[model samples]
Each structure stands twice: as structure tokens, then as C-alpha cells.
Target: MGRQYAVIGTGAIGGFYGACLQKAGLDVHFLLRRDYDYVKEHGLAISSTFGDFTLPQVNAYNQVENMPPCDVVLIALKTTQNHLLPHLLPPLLKPGTVVITLQNGLGVEPEIATIVGETAQVLGGLCFVCSNKIGLGQIHHLDYGQIQLGAYGNNHQPQGITPTMRQIAADFEQANIPIQLAENLLLARWKKLVWNIPYNGLSVVLDATTDAMMKDSYGYQLSEQLMREVIAGAAGYGLEIKESFIQKMLDYTMKMKPYRTSMKIDYDCHRPLEVEAMFGNPMRAAQAVGVAVPQITMLYQQLKFLDARNIAIGN
Candidate 1:
């Protein structure tokens, strides 16, 4: 049989990619939360700049135990909901199941290892897609759907490109999704953070879209500064991200569609911002290595306060 797949947390990221994998004629199951009933009745819809398609029917489940054990499990849940993993993972896992975490932030893979143990292999998938859940059972893919994947050892060290990594890459490539295999997982996370930190943080704090941020003078300069701080922090942690990446990401963002960040969207929807995963962990990592990132530290402090205030006020 072909690879059996399970997608937990079928929101924007999970729903979009899981739909793509299913469209590839693979046997894919989606374990949904809020959108479960709607998707179960009407199926999932993806509106993408590349093209638009709708699946009339999908193997959808409301609970993890209702799904069968699968060969690959794609976790697309928010890091905030990760406390449920110890309870959620046991039902859908089996021997030789490869768990791929498609969540944001650092230090995620090791956390999965602690729960899944040696029975299942875990990988980190850093998605560069900009998409959102516009409604129940709907995903809007704006631009960029490339994924960078890395292998994680039991101790969470980078194991370089392995056979399983290559196979998964081929599988994604077959589905017409761009895939990059990273020999170093930490470095890949740091590189993605170079873009995420500035864009996600500023979009919420300044209340602007990415294009608007790039167009304005203060926004442009501060974003550049934050990018530089990310580079410094990574280097201090012995994961040296190149200085050239800043300009590369800047140029890319300048040409992209005028878009709101995920964090900004979460804030608008009253969902809790991933303050700890995106900022807290990185700031603490830098401090552990005696690296001072004043700009990032300030952003972290501001975002933490804002997040707390939003949560306290029920928004």
C-alpha cells in the first residue's frame, strides 16, 4: 500500500498541505477540531494563487482515536496546544511511523521525541507558505509553498539528510510542492526565524501588512535591525546564519503580495499569540550563550506584554 497519512490540526497550514497530499491520490486522514463537522459534511476547499480546488470528500475524523494508525503523521497544531500532544499522539501512531512537525518556533522536535520515544521517527518541516483559514474548512494560499525538512535524532541533534528524509522529499516533490532538505535542523529554524521574527513581530506591533511595513521608512529600518539581531543570536548559539540572508529576505518580502502575518491574524481573531515559541525561546537561547540582542529583546518584551493584555481582556 502507498503511505498512509494523518494530519492533526487541520487549520490553515495543516488543511492546505493535507489537502494537497490528498489531492496527490495518497490515502490521507484529517483529524480536525472546530472545522470537523463542516469539513466532514462539505469537504475541504483550498483557494490558492497557484490554482483553486475543492475535495468533495475526505477521510475526516473528529477525534484521534477514531483514526487508524498511519505511516506518516503531520502535526500542524499551534505550539500553544502542544500540551495535548501526549494525549493526542498515542492513538494515531504505530511502529515505524514518521512524525513530521510543521509547527513554528524552536526546540519543537525534541519535545515530540519525549512523547513518541524510539518507536517512531520525528522530523522538522519548516513551511514557507503564507496561507490562512478564511472560514470553516477553507484555506487561502497567497504565495510561497516551499518546505525545508530536517531529520532529528533521539537527542534532537541534526542527523543531516537521511534516506527517510530523501523519500519524504520525493513524495512532496511528486505532489508539485517545492522541498528543500536541510542537513542542519537548528540552522534551518534560525534561518526561517530571520524572516518570521521581524515580519510577524512588526506586523502585530505596528498594525501593518508586510508590504506596508516595507514601504515605510521606520518599518523597513527596524525590520532590518531585527534581522541582524537574529543573525547575531544564532551565531552566538553556534548556529551561524549568513549575513547575506537579511538582504535576501528583504528583497523577497518587498516583491511579495501585501499580506498580514499569521501573528497579526491571530491577534485580530482574538487567538493567543505564540509569544513564547516565536520570541521567548529565541531570546532565552541568546541569553544562555551570552549573546545580547537588544532589538529582539525589546520586541519580545513588547509582544509579551501585548499578548498578556490581549488574553486578559479576552481578545
Candidate 2:
């Protein structure tokens, strides 16, 4: 039997990985809604700048009940759906099931670990992909579709995960993609957080591309400052993300020329946004460490108001 895997939320991240693994001949399933029905009729359609392929038919579900026990569960839902995990996770999990969480908010590792326990392995991931869901079973690839996963089992520890993580890394490496067992996964998460916390909000507020928004005098300085504050707060918690790390982040941002944060995409579609996923958690962390994240706090509040107003207006 092939390695059975299931992906919850067939959006860009989950859909991309599922399609890859399925194309590689592994048994993969998806939990979706009407998208599943559309995909059932139209199949999985992926069109990328690099290439395009169409899967005639792929498995998908409208609810958690339709899922079967799987060896691995990739959770890729928006951060706004974090609370829904407690109700949805139990049915699909069993002892030895690995639940890989690719969610965006901060401090979710612990919550997931607490809920899933020894029955499932909770791992964190950072996805560099900037994609959009163009249609059911169709994800429009923009750029930077790479992923890095934490090797730690839970709470940033390596216990009970060396062999499995090595296998995962090897499998991904053989798949001809950049995959690594991060030495300091927490720091990696923090670095990625620096990109999201400010950039996501900045893009939504300014309604601009990364290069257009970030290249300007004001946006550039503000983004860097917000990143510094976040890094300092991380340092207070004993995670020292060095200056070099920040420089690399800037390098990555520069490459995202026409980039728009995922939240910005959500804003454009007038759909529900994951403000708490990228913004709520970081500001909470800064407060916990006594870091004065005045700019970040201000940005978060402004975006929160906008998101809330949109939600209230039933947009």
C-alpha cells in the first residue's frame, strides 16, 4: 500500500503538496467543501508559470466525517479557524497519526500538541509559496513555492522525531525540492513571522505590491523597524535571530516584486481574513516579553478595524 496521507483545507498550501504527492503516486485525500464537488466533476487543475497539469479525478470531502484514518494529516487552514480544530481533529486521528500543522498564527504548536497528544505528532511548517485559489481544485501559482518544516516533535524538542523527520526530509529531497530538518526551527518560525506580521498588514492597508509598497521610503523603514521589534521580543524569549537573518529576510522581500500578502488577497476578494493568524499572535508575544511594539500594535489595530468592519458589513 502507498503511504496514505490526508490534507485538510484544499487551498494553495494543502492542494499544492497533495497534488505533488499524489502525482508521485502516493494515496492522498483532501477535505474541502463545494470545491470538492467542483473538483469531482472538473478534476484538479493546476496552472503554474513553471508548468501546468490536470488530474482527471482526485479524492476530496466536504466535512471532517468523510475522511478516513491516515498516516499523516496536513492542517493548512487559515488562522481564523484555529478554534475549530478542537472539534474537527479528534475524528480523523488515531495513535501514531502525524498531524503536521502549517497554520500561520504564533504559539499554535503548544495548543495543537495539547489537543492531539501522543496520538499525533505535531510539527510546524513555513511555506514560502504565494499562490491563489483560482477555482475548485485549481491553484494559481504566483512564485516562491517552497516549504521548510520543523524537525522538532513538539514544544521545539527533537525527542521521538529523529527517524521520522529524517525520512520526511529524505522523501522531500528525493522529490527534487528544497526540504530540510531545521536546526533551530523556532528561530525559523520567528523569521517567517517577521515577514507576515507587518508585510501582510502593510499590503492590505496600502493595497500595493511588495516592491511598490516596500521600496518606498516610508514602507521600507517601517517594515524594517517592525521586524526589529519582533526580533528583539524573540530574543527576550532566548531565540536570538541575528542581524544576518534579518538581511536575508530583506533579500527575500526584494525578490517578491509584485508580491501581495495572502491577507491582501483575502481583502481583495472581500472574504474572511486571517488577521488573528498573522497579527494577533505576534502582538500578544511582544506584550508577553515587555517589548513596546507600538508600530506593530498600531498597524494591527488599524487592520483589525478594517477587517472587523468588513466582517460586520457581511462582505
Candidate 1 off by > 4 Å: 154-156
Residue 149's lDDT within candidate 1 is 95
Question: Residues 261-282, candidate 1, lDDT per residue (tens digit)?
Answer: 9999888877889888889888
Give the local distance difference test score of model 2.
0.76
Clashing residue pairs, candidate 1? none
TM-score of 2: 0.93
Q: Going through the candidates in order, what is the number of backbone clashes in each?
A: 0, 0
Model 1: lDDT of residue 104? 94
Best by lDDT, which number? Answer: 1
**lDDT, candidate 1, residue 101?**
97
What are the lDDT scores of the predictions, listed in order?
0.90, 0.76
